[model samples]
Target chain A: MRRNLAIVPAFNEADSIAPTVAAIYQWAPDFDVLVVDDGSTDATAHRASKAGATVLRMPFNLGIGGAMQGGYIYALEHDYEVAVQVDGDGQHDPRHIYELLDHLREDPELNMVTGSRFLASSGQGFQSSAARRAGIRIFSSLVSLITGQRVTDPTSGFRMTNRRGIELFARDYPHDYPEVEAILLIHAHRLRSCEIPVLMQPRLTGASAISSTQSVYYMVKVLLAVFVGLFRRRPIEAGDRPAMAVEHAL
Target chain B: MTKITLQRGLAIAVTLGLLLLVFELVRRKRLSERYAILWLVAATTLFVLAVWKGLLTSLSHDVGISYPPSALFAVAIGLIAMILLHFSLAVSRLSDQNKVLAQRLGLLAQRLEKAEERSADARAAPVPGKRSALPDHSEAEAEAPVPAQELSTRR
Candidate 1:
């Protein structure tokens, strides 16, 4: 038996939210799910509620950063032992959730585990548009360069976080392009992070917020945010072995 | 007594002076476009009345005095200041609205993250010993939380 919290931020996702919530019930029945419906013009909130998910409806849409940050706060308040972010568009495979959580549960120091479509390294289950994938790769490379860790899928929205990750995120989740900025944030806080292979389905319903224009903005803004974070981070305790190296050696 | 040309020249000078002050005020953000219009209108009208004192002064004084150009200029300046002050208050209200929107968005993110977790749980086999989340909900107490309680570092 396990106790976990899943944060699902949705907007105009009426078509797939019910099935996504239903799938979550199938993957981890013991976990409690909360829907942060960010002012959906559709019936996303009502459907999530009917599906037995606790709905936290925002008065207006605040994009991905605000939605995910809400989940971090909830995780902190309710004292969830493990927290995972599940996208509302039904792209993420909830089954891999157990895998991501398992890694964190095994080690107290490992605070963040993200689901990476590229971790499998087999190109299977990669359904994002070519343009989107190209953008993801660019950002992933940029994050890897900044953090000194190769994050194969920097934009992967699916993640499992420990108490440390939750606290850090609750404080300063990026307003947009949370995945990239969140990686930098995890590094800034001296938290350990890893990416695990996961299946991502093509969105069954609507368009993504990461449009052509948004992709350009996401790249520019996230890069700037990462640069600022590097300066803002408290001096990493001198000569402390990097978390990944230590975790891997152990 | 002053010559007609001299009096008319002074009236134009007073109007120009007020107009110059307005240009400076605009640069400092002390006055907005809408309010500036009223100031300019009042200033110009006073200038016209100053030169044609006989008609304006007939009621107020015996012959040569009217609402003096300089006095009317003072009133317009005061009106602009009051109008600008009110505009400042309006900007402050907008700032407040932006703050509230941001706070609510933060709360929404927390709820969405929780929903993602719940949805993940929906996928797995239901087991016993589940821990209660959202202690804010009274119903949470009845159902035990899952053994997978992964709270790594509690404060």
Candidate 2:
């Protein structure tokens, strides 16, 4: 039996943290839930712990990237074979975790599997605002063009990874608005990542992390990060990992 | 002649003042020796330029600048830029280390909590024959004991 972990990064999501943690447990009983309380001022840590999820309370806010990297580091240290990121705001359906896990298990070559809301099968899920959707489309096309694979939702945080992906992310991850750049990082390391259709719900509570005023800034920053990611040196070659090669053979 | 002498004296005085300020900061441990070296070099160069009447003029002429004072301005700007850039690099490194420290701290805290819970569980359900699952006496013994007189001094 493979060890599985669900990493939920939350910041002041006191209203939704407990239910989100519980839902992940309900949907995937085998997976150990680890909620990263990103220095929430509210009772998020307490509620998450009460919901039976192990909580790693950061001393201060390091944003989403730092929080998720903490979870990845924990997963790597604990030797979890598979780890899935479930947003604490409850936008990501926990049921889709199985689908992502199945993709990773089925294709050993696939390093990561992201749950995309724009897939045809995803249907009429909450697909963000029109402006953000346009931004997502631009990034989707850019990533698809660069990776030579179709990418519908490059900004989706709902993703699962194998140990190889875990090691890669644990070593190096971007700081702010990292989802799009993370995709480019996967490409840089010559790792395989694909998107699967998943229904996303509207935020259970609280507002979206990116406000209208910040959306323009977010778009420019992410685009710059992506372009810069192209020039970064590849830290790991595809053939370097003998362990992954053996696993693929099996 | 008197005006030129007064200008030279003022320049020398300002450079001397800067050197003394650097020395004072280093002596008080406010500025580190690593950074003090750069300031020392800057002050000494300014002192030389101030005392040497024809040095700045010749250097400016060699660099194709008509004005010697503007050449000094350029050099000062360059030095300031270098120091600012160095500070930026230090700040970037510090923030990176801070992030790593925070992550490690959070992980360690979680592990410590788990270990404490396990120990609490052990103490709560003590076995019959084994040594009681009390807190390890060795941990207490590891600390150096304060003398009774010293302990009572504050009270």
Candidate 3:
């Protein structure tokens, strides 16, 4: 069974949720859509559900990281074979879902694959603003040094993960700047991750919550998380190890 | 009555006083014990140089420095600067760790809320294994699609 799910974490994305979900359906009908609504005050959950997506409303706002963590938890609990992350801000073009899905279809060892805005082989992937580009470069360098592998788009929210990656993240995903630190987390757990070029649209909703100060907060916290991971006791190792079913405990 | 004996004793006193300051800091947790070694060295060096100017001047002359006090003060400042930088790094680490802990707390609270909801739903109704005890609270409202039925010929 190709039980693939696209996990879209949305907060106050009322305007974009319907169109984004519709685009997902048009682009990849086979992939089930799960919208992890982070306790949005707007009609994000309703709109997403109306547009034909599974809605998991967090009790309250848990931010982007918490919302995605909930999606991973759902995937783990329901035994989803594959789970991919798509932004709910109407940024990730549904057209690129095929390109990402193709990578998974090709290799089973590829546990996690990210749609990189900077990895365009044809130089036709989405273009970002200058500040975002700089932030991505800085965070990517940090991930590269820590993971001992090059990562072009460290903060790209467009990512796909197999069962193994989903379970790993469900157990221990970063609490903040998750899309960036997730690369490090996946690496620390010794999982294979790949990045491919994908198309993205500009955000189609309200004002962005990511300010300059927030970017600094994001970078510093992620770097600190990497530093702290070095001292964590009994780190996880990737293999056919026993899965950590932590829903009840959590 | 008190020649170089009191001067030598005063020099030892200042050095020991600086060591005591480092010890006090270590005891109360203002300074990490590992980095306290550097603090101890810095404090002792500054105190010794302050008390024994003649010895430092002679050594400075040997090392071919014109202003011995300025050189010694610069070294002390450099040591202080390095220590401050290290302390700042520790502060940065602690700040994010605090945020991570706060995030974890929020997650735990969410779990607690879900648990309460499940318990409430279980108490409200009892049935065989069909659905979950947790309440299915739809997060989004209004904009979510209504049922596709109910004589919707009018737009």
- Give the winner by DockQ: 2
- Rank the candidate models, highest DockQ first: 2, 1, 3
Ranking by lDDT: 2, 3, 1
The candidate scoring highest on lDDT is 2
Better of 1 and 3 by lDDT: 3
How well is each residue in B97-126 modelled by candidate 3, as lDDT tens digits? 443344345445545755786778777777
Ten-residue region with minimum lDDT total, candidate 1 chain A: A241-250
- lDDT tens per residue, model 1, A104-143: 8887889999998887858789658788778788888888
State each model's CA lDDT, in order. 0.74, 0.85, 0.75
Candidate 3 pairs with clashing backbones: A46-B140, A46-B144
lDDT by residue (A1-250, candidate 2, tens digit) is: 2389999999999999999999998999989999999999999999999999999999999889989988998888877889999999999999998988888999989999999999945457889988889999999999999899999999999999999888888877788898998888888888999989999999999999999878888988998877866776664332222232123222
Estimate candidate 2's alpha-carbon lDDT, on a 0 to 1 scale.
Answer: 0.85
Q: Give the TM-score of candidate 1.
A: 0.64
After the best TM-score superposition of candidate 3, give how far the Cα of residue B103 lies from its true spot, in angstroms.
13
Native-to-model Cα distance after best TM-score fit, residue B68 in candidate 2, in Å: 2.5
Every model's DockQ, to 2 decimals? Answer: 0.11, 0.27, 0.03
Order of models, best TM-score first: 2, 1, 3
Candidate 3, A110-159: lDDT as tens digits: 88889887877645655777887877788788788878888988888899
The residue-level lDDT of candidate 2 at A102 comes to: 89
